[model samples]
Target: MMRSILQVPAEVLSELHATCKLTPYELKLIGELCEILEPFEEATDKCQGDQVVTASYVTACVQGLSHAIAHIRETYKSKFVVTKQSSLGKCLAKFEDMECFQMAATLDPRFKLNS
Candidate 1:
């Protein structure tokens, strides 16, 4: 929805309502949010499919999510830097101690040899 809103022209937004126009900062923030949340969205979609989702698949997804988040943190320097750090920290903390997930990821054929 935010992406859809961002696609609307500034003139159209202003024409719709004086207060409807987003500031440059807000637009940038929204863009950052969309980029940051994309991996999570992809993971969610993959997990929600009709096919079976095993622990190995879920572990791989989580590992992918971690890598993507780390890349985003290292690559982007914006007003949301703190937000990025917070998210990375939370993700690590939540999954760091999950030995089962680690084992599953190591056993998964796709990730078995992955470094």
Candidate 2:
């Protein structure tokens, strides 16, 4: 939705309403936010299915999300995004500490067994 708004011309936005115009900084922030949330959205999509998703798959998804978020934190210039990424990392950290997820991921042939 934010992406769609970003695509609209300033003239169109202004025509829609006086307050509809987004400043350059707001547009940049929205773009950064979209980039930050993309990995989470992909993970959610991967989890949704008629077939059951195993713990190993979920564990892998969490790991992927962590890596993506970490990359964003390191590379992104936005302080707000980096701060939010830190919060997201903290949320995901709990799953990493779970024995079940750890064991399942270790047992899954697709994932490297961590000694």
Best by TM-score: 2
Model 2 scores a TM of 0.70
Candidate 2's displacement at residue 53, Å, is 1.7
Worst 10 residues of 1 by lDDT: 52-61
**Candidates' lDDT values, in order?**
0.72, 0.79
Clashes of each: 0, 0
User: 1-115 in candidate 1: lDDT tens per residue?
Assistant: 9889789887877678565567889988888788888887897776566765455566666667778877887767665755755765676456645887668767777654845
Per-residue lDDT tens digits for candidate 2, residues 27-115, read 88888888888998898887667785467667778888878877887878678767767776787768877898888778878777667
Model 2: colliding residue pairs: none
Model 2 weakest lDDT span, ten residues long: 47-56
What's the alpha carbon RMSD for model 1? 3.5
